[model samples]
Target chain A: MSAFTRFTPLIQSLPSTIPFVGPEAIERQRGRAIAARIGANESGFGPAESVVQAMREAATGTWKYADPENHDLKQALATRLGVSAANIAIGEGIDGLLGQIVRLVIEPGMPVVTSFGAYPTFNYHVVGHGGRLVTVPYVGDREDLDGLLAAVKKENAPLVYFANPDNPMGSWWPAERIVEFAKALPETTLFILDEAYCETAPAEALPAIDAFIDMPNVVRTRTFSKAYGLAGSRVGYVVTTPGTAQAFDKIRNHFGMNRIGVAAAVAALADRDYLATVTARIAHSRERIAEIAQSNGLSPLVSATNFVAIDCGRDAVYARAIVDTLMSDHGIFIRMPGVAPLNRCIRVSTGPQAEMDLLEAALPNVLAKLAGGQ
Target chain B: MSAFTRFTPLIQSLPSTIPFVGPEAIERQRGRAIAARIGANESGFGPAESVVQAMREAATGTWKYADPENHDLKQALATRLGVSAANIAIGEGIDGLLGQIVRLVIEPGMPVVTSFGAYPTFNYHVVGHGGRLVTVPYVGDREDLDGLLAAVKKENAPLVYFANPDNPMGSWWPAERIVEFAKALPETTLFILDEAYCETAPAEALPAIDAFIDMPNVVRTRTFSKAYGLAGSRVGYVVTTPGTAQAFDKIRNHFGMNRIGVAAAVAALADRDYLATVTARIAHSRERIAEIAQSNGLSPLVSATNFVAIDCGRDAVYARAIVDTLMSDHGIFIRMPGVAPLNRCIRVSTGPQAEMDLLEAALPNVLAKLAGGQ
Candidate 1:
């Protein structure tokens, strides 16, 4: 149990933790294989066939380091987004970019504002860097923009995080409201407008690329992991002013990207037809999830993401029981929010029909078992 | 040029910079393609055919996020090293792990000790986290362990970095001396024993795993990027006390690893026979590089790495001229250290005879042109 005694006080104070226990960990612990892999918001539809081919082709170049400047990928993204390459900074994933953003702005004891039950990984980074968290409660199931703004102003917080088409709850505000919230924030505050699930959201839910392109304080993080169906590719980027985007170079691991992953991401981005097909499939799966939840007498929250949050109509205990039972008994892995109210809903990611079929079969029995326990 | 006005004072004080300019950047700036990419110390010999096949096979699973715990890879490493899984922590690469280790022990303005011009990327991370650097100059082209020990004590620095069979210089200490150096450091000081080139080093240059296994303050980093020839795969790990190893879980992007990259690494580890063959090839290439430098009247330093650093027998200007002329005129990419003393040498990575033939043909002309310039 001996540890290096001289770790920074902040690092020492933080707990050794993970934002979510992966399905692999659960399978190892329970001695069972997962039948339905829909817990972590990954697209079960997989990447385009062309992406796999690109990755395989790139594999031969595995002995060379990835381009430290990320030139080609940036140029490709800029062309796709109709922005200059200088306005984009790529990293391993949105999760990795979030960590870098936290490091850039959060000094010891600086205030960072976000929702109470927001992405735990962001909170973990904020705390690891000694930033004080100022939490705003979710108003209903959606992140409360007003509450977040109020907290930011009150604390004069330097940074804030807001995810559109949010995780865990699968709720979102429309484009205008989101733009309004970004514009209303103080110019001193750096707003991380995470659009991780934007591809799965209704078109009306997303703001135009130019809407906040000129706003230096607003950084929109997007990823190929979700709708592009290359979760394991580890490609994500931030759209911001050139100056703000350049700041990432000061601290990011310059040669840290995997070359094959970048190739896969580039190919995935080029395959627009495949993306459209996947989006349609995800929408259908979301509808199927809602139908299954409703049939089981659970209320499914209206969703803008590739997932649904079904209210079990009880407390966190009941929700917890259902989540555990589904995985343990049926090998159907799903998750719930970490805090109350939100914890009453279990989150399930949209997947292919086979996974959807597994979920359909498991939910009824899980509910029955949980009800029997109660 | 607009940016968030309220970034932390440390971030505001830091400049946006990249430690190394990628070959791609140089090519773009010069409007030329790299004909011989014997720069950045990357293995142009490429990864094993088996490893490449493994990556191709893993490409289809790019939809699934790599296991957060990295169980399979950890198990493979542990079994290979005759250690427990708890002794290992996996990361994107040694570069990524170095950043994490610096973050673990360094707070703003805290003293960090390393050999001057040892590793620029490590220095970049230390500065990014606001740590003050205390550098000891390299003695006789090998890191002066005694001088480093003195600086660590003088500053009471909590972190010290030492790379055996070091980069840029390709020099190393005997295994006994390295072990002695690790044992000599204050228990409060964390020693980063970087062994990124261990596979290329003679057995006498590396301590047995058990030598420092019980020391909570010692962390040994290894990478598949070197001898395994999987630099783009971006797989690296730290071997340390279980407690010290667990600290990474607190702050690492748990799901950051690319699936195919991990698969390549595990496969690379399993094929030791391929590694042995690659190691011999690298040694042969290194000798050829040294001979090439000698034939050009440059003094090639003795190398224990995949690259050779040749003394240009003048100053930084001469070294820089040779590097620039080689690239611009011959499309041969190579590099040199940034600081004085070391900058008198141009470093070249080992590659196939074709690249060596390019160097062998180009170096004489480039040297003659540099002599004419003077």
Candidate 2:
């Protein structure tokens, strides 16, 4: 059957896709369960006991729509960030918030700037909204903040996206450089500073929350998905000037939040000791992944996030084969970048010791097989 | 601080608004704890014990993102609906789906049609997307099927909304007329056949699942929120042709579904006995609400939903006073319609006996005060 013949030209032009194939989809396609899931940058250490308890407690009350105002969660976030509740806007995840931000800023054919190999979900949203993308390549595996600002000016772009402790490459720019980039951008250009992995990054790598508190042009997005290990709960929030934050209220699906997720996130925020313990484990896992890579004669990139991007010492084709071989032959799930040069590396998320052991054992075998075949 | 200088003109034109204030907001504003929660059409009876069990079970696995394909939930929903999984598109809720649907078909200035006060959230979405709402007023408190079709033809509108077992007034039309309305619409005029209250409505009031299955232009939206009692779970779906259903995947937040919510919805669908039990309770509560309205000399509209619209024999001011007085004097929460004539009635959701008893006790006293006042 044909689709309704009248979908706006832009929607009709788009395709159903995701930035990365989920592990569940891989398991289904390969007809095998994933023995080790170290992909998608999800923290496999799991949420704090308090968060699980909160989710379990909130489960029975799943008949009431979450408050449209998201009063409690926003207040909790605001208190933690030392900002007022009006300065935060909560969303399903950074992915959902990206879509809303695109809708707010980009009309058809409007230019948006971002690194060519940055978060694909942000690009998906911009294209879904018919925004024209102006791509800038990464510099030294990190987002080119200078190039991004220059492109924003050249195109008179209204929006730019920069992820700190970035995805795929697992690289970061220092907080001072980030703040400088934000200050250098034209006032009319709104910058989405995605800090999804902020908790796992080093102290100096993150700006103080107050650094851009007065700039309506900046929205720093964060999520409980990484350090808090609540990816499936879909809780993410943004901090911006109160005026810009309120703009989300004008068009957001006001009652869209899942109640238990909100409860989980609130509980996760309160469990500081759990967060500290998990980050230490993540740091250990990152070291283990790098060790595995170096032992296999691969170059592991220095990472500030919860993942290690190891250069496979070959082209995209070789990296692709190793990724497929790991999952198909070993039941291990990992990912790679979509763009060339970056695609020469494979990205593995930090996880529990058992999964690390599985990855540690699987990597050498997959590498040996690939080298023999080549 | 002001918002950034250049949100798309359309976004800048819109105001931050909520369709209806939530009961939580009411509690916060009035500094009164709600003793009886019957507002906003939530099932105060709550979700099934089985669904709650499922959500609790799913809570620990909150570290992994939900399957973007939503494979299990879609398969289960498809089996129950006797439709292919391809024919269904899952979303956060009907409210979220409405936002997606609007974005799919609407560009700035495009005309969409629905009753003036049918569902404020739907109107909010249309206006949010820059779609011009061509509203047709309700005829005799029920959506005028003929009028909606006429508006679609006159405006050449690409989208129209009609809710069976409608909100606010709790009115409905028979299946035959609804089917006829669907078949008579211009094929290009996509109709949103909102069946939110289908389970609570009389059997004859709803068209069969297959009634408009072949028509690509008719998309039926149903929610676990209304009948299955998973409102906070945020699970809703659309039944349409596979092609149109797939259109949602192109623009939706692919990994946005909360894992526990999906599990809860799937469990809710399987608990048939619980659904039957709750529907009966809803019917009983509806009658009790009518009794309370009649005993107080108010006229209760014939309801096909889990709510009753009681005409208090006055203008919006008197209805508003009753709503306010109920909250302030007795902490009984309820709502009224937004538009004139319909605003003369207050709406109450069906719930457990304790809440019904509270409403039963409070209404007469509130009414007496209103009548005695100037």
Candidate 3:
């Protein structure tokens, strides 16, 4: 394959590892319809009707570029969080924001710290920008705050990422411990406290918005993707000091946001009742997912967010077989962690009752087929 | 004003220079509404009714992330462009794609080349990634292709940008000349043939799709933002060799695209009649703008895009005064070139008849006020 010859050495050295293989690709590759569309942590409960209506209403103005400063969404977010608009920054989503954050802080050969099996997207950005990854293992299925802080200190790393109600394991740390971790980190270390799943997590699991309001080194990343069910709308924001938030303006694609998405986010923020109702639905669905996993002879990890991680009581291969078989035979789409022992579990997202019903019916037969194959 | 102390020296040294101050900012600053939003080069004609309907329908699924692979859109672009899917890369918009291109090829101190007053967003990306810009002056109000090629070779610059049916000046080279320039560049220099305005350009001015299909060193960027009237949709793509296109995956936000926007683009592509109708309308708007400029004692440059650049035949200050007065006094929004001598012109985006009428009525008043003030 003849390629552009003069790509920087860093780019030339990078591999094409997309953060997550979307379910659309899976359907294409496997040639199967996904009946239980509960993969990728997407909310099949869908966006609030009000938010959808807002997007539809904004559709006519699709000819106009979104505000480059993202003024309205930031204003709404600032009001909701009780911070000034200058203290917020918005982007395509957490994935895009993570990429920008990496670019802003990590120079070539710099070190970045995260849990070993955390969000692959962040790792991809780190390596893409030539930042070395200094990873610590998850402790008890939750991101090990002590381990992450220690790695940052040991490497004197300038950047660290931690997710509350984390992906894959659906685990979380207490608000106090999270605050402690943030306060303990060096001021030189720019901590990305990704609260993407915070809305679905228990109240105790989330630090108060004011906790890190004054912390210059701490930027808490949140998304409308999970609890608000606007994942594909691609609205995400970060909360930090005005100075740190302003840094995003220095490097962000200012005109990158889609107009309807911004309207959807602003509407999503305003529909607090809908947000509450959907999060309650999400919590109920999480319970349903855990119940289904437990009934299938698997030990489902306790989850604070909108998914349950089932330990299949075997190795990674067994978990992989279950994941593959469920998809191939039953078209029940779910995902697994990238690294073991995290990989000993398959992650299932909470969705509508119909999707849960499909998972409930399919898992037993797939597990039986797997056992018989041996 | 405290910031994360450990941001890279390059990041610390950078100022918060946003690419374009959004009209929203202007409204806030001037305390006035933008009655005619013809700045930003966004199409006021809007997307096809079918496309808008598609977005409205897709809004419910905003709960799901867009396909990371962008399979269907790539397939559609491939079929339309007579290239394999691997030869295409989709991004948020041209601005977003330009940022990625800069990241892929530029490192600190790398001399990136482009027309002196070409796209500021492109320059923003280059400087954001620490690439020093080596600008070639535009000759006769058009991007000087020959000068750009010369600078690319002289600087041994890995990257160069040239836009056809250009923004700010609305000037273009014929297809043969564009292809000749592309073919003439050294194989080591990666050239960005930005064809964002191709949909509105004369047929003879656009190179054949096959012109650089096999040229690994050349990538052409196009957007739905222009003549397609989907600027707020944030859909843009690049056409290049499969090898070169694959490079975007190495660093792109895999799930960055918004779902409804992709659906809208697909719908817009399918509705060929609407595209033709809108382009014709844009052509008419261009003529209207030209007539308006001529009546105001300004020289309007010939255009092959969705806008016209009116030569105010004055210095940058006078042009600045015209732009400001149009916005402040008449609620008319327009933009102008940033650098002299290109700054002698004011760029106006082609829009609906009502917007044109507003400009027709407002321009003489604003210009007369400027003349009287002097």
Candidate 4:
């Protein structure tokens, strides 16, 4: 139980708690293999064959460290997004970038703002840097933008986070409203506009790529993890003003990138047809998930992302029971929101038909078992 | 030029600088492709075929996020090292882990100790955290372990870094001396024993795997990047007491690991025969490099690493000329130590015979051109 006695006071004060328990941990704990891995919202549709080919080819070159500047990847991303490579900063994932962003803006006791029950990992980074979080409750199962702005102003917080096509709730605000929210924020407040789910989100749900290009206060994060189906590859980037992008260089591990992962990401960006096909498949799968929820007398929330959050028409306990029973009884893995109101819904990721089939067959029995108090 | 104006004073004050200019950047700057990629200390001998196959297999599963706990990889490393899974923490690489370690121990203005010519990435992390560096100079081309201990004691530095079978110099201290050094450090001073080159070192050069397991203040860093030829995979781990090991979870990006990279590491570990073969090849390549240096009228230091540091028998200017001419005139990319004394030597990574041949054929001419002052 011994530990180094001289860790910083902020580090000492923090708990060694993880933001989320992964599906793999759940498998180990339950002593059962998951039949449907829909919980984490990863695309079971998978990446393009071309991307797989690229990753396989890149494997032979694994002896060399990846380019520290990530020049090629940046050029590819910049070209695709219609932004300059100078405006982009790449990291292991959006999660990693979030940690860096938090470190850049926050010092001990600094106030930060985010929606209650939004991304817990963001909260983890905030607290890790000794930043005090001022959370605004989600309204209508969507992140409360106005509330977040109000809290930021009242607390004079330096940082705020908002995820579009948000997790757990499968809800979103329109692009115009989001743009309005960014414009309304004080220039001193750094806004983290997380667009991890933008690939699958409706076109109207996302702002033009350049909408915040001139706003130094805005940092939009995008990732290859969702519709691109490279979650395990762990490639993500930030789009910000050139100066803000350069700030990351001051703190980032220059050679931290995985070569094969970067190759997969580059290849993923090139295969536009695959992206279109995957998004269509993801949309279809979402429909299937919604149908399964409705057949079991549940209401599925409207979704722009690659997942459906079904309202169980009950409390957190009921939703938790369903989530647990679905995994325990049928080896179907799905998640639920961590906080109330949203916790009444069990979130299901869009996957191929096989996972939807497992969900379709398991939900009724799970609900019936819960109703019968067993 | 716009940036978020509210960055913490420490971050704002720091200039954006990278620790090393990657060879890829050199290619871009010079507008030429490198023929010999023996810089950055990466293995051009490449990872085992088994590892490549494993990475290819894992590529399809890129749709799923890597396990946040990294349970399987930890179990594999623990079983191989005869340690418990709780005793290890995995990171993107030693560089990423160094950043985390610095964050854990250093606050603004705190002193941090390391050899002056040691890993620049470690120094980069300290500076990024606003830690004041208290550097001990290398004595006789080896890290000044005694000097490091004295500095740490004098400054009451909470963190100290020492790389055995060191980078940039390719020098090492034997097992007993390293153990003695560890035992002499104050309990409050966290010692980072970087063994990034251990796989290529002689057996007597490494302390027993369990030698410092009970010492909470000691965290031994290791990587798959060296002899395993998986530098681009970005997998590294720290072996330490369970309490200290768990501390990484408090601030790390939980899903930060690349799934394919982890698979490659596990496969690399399982293929013990390949590791032995690659290490032998690395040793042979190092010998070949030494012979080449000797033939070119330069003195190569005795090495226990995948690279050899060759003394150019002059100042840093001459050494710089040799490195630059090799790259510019002959497409031979190599590097040198960043600081004086060590900077008198040019560092060359061990690679395939083709690269060695390229170096052998090019070195004399590059030296001749430098001697001619053109």
Runs of candidate 1 with Cα error greater than 4 angstroms are none
Worst lDDT run of 10 residues, candidate 4 chain B, spans: B365-374
Off by over 4 Å in 2: none
* lDDT digits (tens) for residues A255-366 of candidate 4: 9999999999999999999999999999999999888999889999999888999999989999999999999999999898899878999999999999898899999999
For model 1 chain B, give the 10-residue run with minimal summed lDDT. Answer: B2-11
Query: Compared with the true structure, what per-residue lDDT tens digits does model 2 show for residues A196-305?
Result: 99999999899999999999999999999999999999999999999999999999889999999998998998999999999999999999999999998999999999
Candidate 4 CA-lDDT value: 0.93
| Candidate 1 C-alpha lDDT tens digits along B276-342 | 9989999999999988888878899999999999998999988898899999999999999888899
Ranking by DockQ: 4, 3, 1, 2
Worst 10 contiguous positions by lDDT, candidate 4 chain A: A1-10
Give one digit per residue, the lDDT tens place, for model 3 in B196-273: 999999998999998999999999999999988899999999999989999999988989999999999999889999
lDDT of 2 at B240: 95
Clashing pairs in 4: none
Cα deviation of A55, candidate 4, in Å: 0.7
Q: Which structure is stronger by DockQ: 2 or 4?
A: 4
Interface RMSD of each: 0.8, 0.9, 0.8, 0.7
For model 4, the stretches where C-alpha displacement exceeds 4 angstroms are: none
- Measured by TM-score, how close is model 1 to the native structure? 0.99
